[model samples]
Target: MFTLSDMWTFFLAFFLTLPLVTLVHEAGHVLAARAFGAKIKFTLGAGKTLFKIGPLEVKRLYFMDGWCQYESLKYDKLWVHIFIYISGSLSNLAVILVINFLIYQGTLPVHIFFYQFVYFSVYFIFFSLFPFKTGEGQPSDGLAIYEVIKYGKKADPID
Candidate 1:
């Protein structure tokens, strides 16, 4: 039977897990953008800026939303844009794979976080790699990639 305590635990876990997942996911784009030498203005959340570091900005409400902005991204090569878009999901998948490898090698304990990590990795990766938009019309990374694949550079939903 589900109880109040279980509901509370679930909510608590959601908050904690969501933020970490979002950070890592966005970090994937940031890293890939940097690798492409694209000038970026990345933010992970809304509201006023809580902190700024060169091209990165952390917002006060920095847990619900995140996006990486870069100029000429719409004009970049297909591979470059693809790298920037899929890097986050790819990172999550990579982490899950590495963990599985470690488990196979008899190292690293299997625990709740491990399961949570794998679950969320596959969940987010699937959604992020799917061609869909949020209620606000923000396209998923997969949608962006599909656009590029089908229509070429002008298909960039972001600018």
Candidate 2:
């Protein structure tokens, strides 16, 4: 049975935790792009723009989605593309492992919030790593990586 408390938790997880996880995932891509000397734009969400600070933009529907767009990398190597595409999932995994370690060591109290964060982080990783192109013709992180490795170029190159 779903109680009022459960509903509140769900709301919190949906609005707050999920977006934070998404940001972490997107940040991974941005970091990788920066490492490869690519000019990038990182947007968090869709619809009306709430604010723009440098390359990072926050939108009204922040929890809906996020993406990192980068110009051609200085390296421009096959390995660079693969690393950029895979970094998002890797970042989420790193966060999950760190949180789990903290909880296990009794440094952080075991709580539902942390649990939800880890859960959503894993969810992000799984979906991000699942190869598929969206109806809008946008390739997912996994799909992009697969395309680069298999075809040696992104089918829909953002750059």
Off by over 4 Å in 1: 1-12, 73-75, 154-159
Candidate 2 lDDT over 46-156, as tens digits, reads 899999999999999999999888876888888888998899999999999999999999999999999999999989999989999877788899999888888998423
The best candidate in terms of lDDT: 2
Candidate 1 TM-score, true structure as reference: 0.79
Native-referenced Cα lDDT, model 1: 0.76
Give the true-structure RMSD of model 2: 1.5
Q: Lowest lDDT 10-mer window, candidate 2?
A: 150-159
Candidate with top TM-score is 2
For candidate 1, the per-residue lDDT at 15 reads 65
**TM-score of every model versus the real structure:** 0.79, 0.95
